[model samples]
Target: MSSLKPIRKAVFPVAGLGTRFLPATKAIPKELLPIVDRPLIQYAVDEAREAGIEQMIFVTGRGKTAIVEHFDVAYELESTMAARGKEMSALGPTRATPGDIITVRQQVPMGLGHAIWCARAIVGDEPFAIFLPDELLIARNGGAGCMKQMVEAYGEVGGNIISVLEVPRDEVSNYGVIDPGERNGALTEVRGLVEKPPVEKAPSNRILSGRYILQPEVMRTLERQGKGAGGEIQLTDAMATMIGNQPFHALEFDGRRFDCGSKLGFVEATLTLALERADMGADVRAMAERLLNA
Candidate 1:
């Protein structure tokens, strides 16, 4: 675990065109979509902050200006809230201090690897984290957030760490499943990675759950990477190259993850999160019961 740098920076790849949401995402970046009251990006950013991330690098594209503005202070809104005596605590988590948030344009919808590579200049030469805003992870029973858990594991392992979740065998092909070598509690020694392998071919049910603590060298691998499974440069392929070279491990997150990129998943996340909030839980439960009966 020598020469391991503290993970201080996190990259959020928010460039994808959210065709899954259609008309709602027509004018808005899907990252700005609200899960309950907070936007999807907020949850991801909050988790990064919890993991001690000092800088946030957002890899964005066209139609992503809303995301930039969302993190900036709204002077007019603040003034209005102050005058109206409205509680300002809710806005605290969404705003980032100046010089802490940075943005880079991907300019093309290449792939996840390409989007992450676009932030290489700003990230420089240190271990950093990647948070997929679409993957909303709710820490089980007030436990540590997903990235926090990965950061703790990275501190001990001192190499690449990716959060993994045990998906059903039949659904393994939908994710980047890991081939396990050894398991010590939540940490699994990653032997290999299969990007969306068939059910019969899947080495394990554990799949990448959109949270990662990665070494900077992976960015260099992505630079020369060619198209993979989706005819676009895949991050999984670049990460797979680092398995033998580094102490790569898969962290099985102790939480529930919602794939907010899809409609069904988005609705599930909204309802689940809403039900978890003390202020709205009762009302949401009542509404859900009514809808179920209707």
Candidate 2:
């Protein structure tokens, strides 16, 4: 196993146009869309911070200024809240100190690979993490957050690790399925990756989750990566090239993942997270039960 460097940097690719959400996203980036109280990106950033990430690099496009501002200190707002005797603890996790975050523009709408490659300079030659803000993962049962779990697994396996979740076999065709080699507990040695394969052809039900701990070399591969499925440069294509060359593993996350990019998924995440909150859980549960029965 290659000696892995401590993952100190995380890349958040927020450049997409978020066409799925339409008019609402026309003015606001989907990443800035609120799951309930916090925006989707906040969850990802909080997870990154929890996993010991020191630097955050956001690959943004037009209309993504909100994301940058969200991490910045709101001096006037803070002052107002302070004077009003309002507890500002809710805003604590959203703050990022100076020099902790760097934003780069992904001027063009390429793909996930291109958005990530745009941050290659800030990433340097270190192993970094990629967090998809649209994928909201909640670690339950006192388990670590998805990225935290991956970082722990990375410590042991010391290679490129991608978070995987076991989807139903019939749904495997909708994701980039992993070709499993060997399994050790929740870690599976990744032998190969098959992107959006037909259900009959999928290697396994385990599909790539949005969290990843990838080596810097993958960025180099993406530099010259050709457009794959959907005429977009695919990150999976770049990652697959390193399968045989490096130690690659898939970590099954101990959490529930919500695909918040879609309307249904976004609603589900909001309701689920709201239902989990201490302040609102009882009320939300009561309302949900009443609605379900009615």
Identify the leading candidate in terms of TM-score: 1
Q: Which ten residues in a row have the lowest lDDT in candidate 2?
A: 1-10
Cα RMSD (Å) per model?
Answer: 1.0, 1.3
Q: What local distance difference test score does each model get?
A: 0.93, 0.92
The whole-model C-alpha lDDT of candidate 1 against the native structure comes to: 0.93
Per-residue accuracy of model 2 over 112-169 as CA lDDT, tens digit each: 9899999999999999999999889999976799999999999998889999999889
TM-score (C-alpha, index-matched) for candidate 1: 0.98
Enumerate clash totals for all models, in the order shown: 0, 0
- Please state the error at residue 276 of candidate 2 in Å: 1.6
- Model 1 residue runs over 4 Å out of place are 1-3
Model 1 Cα shift for residue 235 (angstroms): 0.5
Candidate 2: give the clashing pairs.
Answer: none
lDDT of 1 by residue, 61-110 (tens): 99998998999999999999999999999999878899999999999889
**124: Cα error in model 2, Å:** 1.0
